[model samples]
Target: MEGCRNSKDYMMDVAGRVFVLGVGIDNVNLGEALKRIQEYVENGTAGLVVTANPEIVMLARKSPDFKAYLDNALMVTADGIGILIGARLLGRPIKQRVTGIDLTTALFEQAAAKKYKFYFVGAKPGVAEAAAENIRKAYPGIEIIGIQHGYFNDDSKIIDDIKIKKPDILLAALGMGKQEKWIEERVKPAGVPVSIGVGGSFDVFSGEAKRAPKWIQDAGIEWLYRLIRQPSRFWRMLQLPKFLGAIILSRLFSGK
Candidate 1:
């Protein structure tokens, strides 16, 4: 913890941030976000990184506890196209969407080269292990020191394991709210240099799930692709329109 600092302290020293419906998103592209996490790891600073989308923003709006967690995060990258659109509607344009999966993929390369130790937690029983196996095959020399699936009543064991392993980064995939809260309450205090709520990234890495093709992702309709693939997400996708409407109302009232 040589260069350790709290989230507020770290944020004050970083680049610009854009507020989307009271949720602050760091105005950074993928490279910048990666660089920041690398710096955090190198500096021995502990902080939580949040990859936020429209649904997450909406959830934060409804939950004070969740909002506080976002507010205190070291960095919040825009992970949804709706968030990028919302930022522009508010007259504060974001650079790009830095998705959880993309960022995690990018980190594997860095971790491989730099030998950054990683501890993965969350997803179903075999998901994290499967993801770790794929990661080892894909990124040779990357050090994944620990893996724990997100199915436990108590966190003491997990926290204890993380402390003992002393990983540079902790990737928690316990979904949105739970992941963020877990990182803030458990991982950060455990002294991990950097922790991020990776959502379902493990599923993607494990090949249990598939991402949209590059063309679809570039078209900014990855949400639609996901909806088509997982129709159950239809209800979650509704948040995009609700998010847009909220942004419009926020702009109208604030006149920003």
Candidate 2:
């Protein structure tokens, strides 16, 4: 295990960060975030990257351990519309939304060009393989060093395997809190540089789910499109209002 005390100078020049729902999110654009991630990979710096949305933020609020774990991440991008709204309501403007899928794609582009090795974890039995196949078709030269399903009872073996593989990046798609926790507790210590929690991205890349159109994504209402597609998400969608309420409370109490 490389340990988590490694240098974080890669984040020194980050555009800026703002605390919303008590989690510090970087205000950089996607390009800047990708550049920082590349630095981590090239320099062999072990760290975790977080894609924080409303659901993940609420989970963090409910779990002190998770919140503290997030603080230790090398970067936490605003991945949800609620994060942008919360930042604006607090008078802090984030530059853009850096969704996990976008981030993964960006890294894939770089890996293809630079021949950086990648390891993917999470998703159903064959979903990761399917996603990797799709990525190979898209990025011809991208090297996928390893992959594993998320149904394991213990993570010790997976962590050891990642340490042995030493891929430049590890994308974990084990949902929200679980993915982040796995990255922090297992992947990061295994010396994998630029570990990211990409919830359900494999499903999309593997053709199990369809992403909303670019227009919808540009309009920043992909959440609505998702709810329309997966009506079962209706209950989870209720958290948006709760997130907003929490932001309002944060503003009132902090006087920011």
Candidate 3:
């Protein structure tokens, strides 16, 4: 019960919140976001950290269940350039984009130095293992207590294992919706101090997928890079324009 902070109480501290299309995105930079997570770990508070992009925000707009999850999440950082643009249009500019991969990689550095335990669950078979191995190499002393592929039919075993291992942080890369839902419904309840939906971070870490270059990411065109790299994401990329359009419409109507 101590880990489960009430959603109302969490949202009451509105100093860093920017509402975009009815979803609250924290206006913290990457360092601030990491500091909050470190606080969670130190306080032994169970929390769901959502790295929400335009796609995820749009999905939350369309789905009540998803929207509820976002509303209740302990922290929702702006994970996409579209989110920052939308916040600006809404006259509530966010500080920066705190992406899942960047946050996770930063956390690894802290975990390595602080000796925090980790449990990684998601990505394709062998992918999480590969990422774990690479992580071990990169962060020599970091403790990864458990690893599991996301291809399971039932998550009971995985949940049980996580409960037992009780890692300080749990990273689930089961894509967007599923990963968030899993972290909220399963990992948080299992009492993990910090749980995050990492999307394809494992794939990136495993070298199965390459992230966009620094310039592309800084230019806020990483979406374009991703689309160019994986043409199959054309449909997903379409969400960007839709998200921007909605923001413009909202601003026009509300005179924000």
Q: Give per-model TM-scores.
A: 0.93, 0.91, 0.94
Q: Which residue pairs does candidate 2 place in steric collision? A: none
**Model 3 stretches astray by more than 4 angstroms:** 1-13
Tens digit of per-residue lDDT, candidate 3, span 45-71: 997999999999889877889988888
Cα deviation of 17 in candidate 3 (Å)?
A: 0.8
Considering only N, C-alpha and C atoms within 3 Å, which residue pairs clash in candidate 3? Answer: none
Instruction: For residue 9, give model 1's deviation from the true position in Å.
Output: 22
Instruction: Report lDDT per candidate.
Output: 0.87, 0.84, 0.86
- Kindly report which residue stretches of model 2 are placed more than 4 angstroms away from their true locations once superposed: 1-15
Maximum-lDDT candidate: 1
Write one digit per residue (lDDT tens) for candidate 2, span 113-214.
Answer: 766899999999999999999999999889999989988998788888888888998889898788888788777777887889999899999999999999
Write the candidate numbers in order of decreasing lDDT.
Answer: 1, 3, 2
For 78-187, candidate 1 gives per-residue lDDT tens digits of 99999888888777788999999899889998887878999999999999999999999999999999999999889899899998999999999998899999899888
TM-score of 3: 0.94
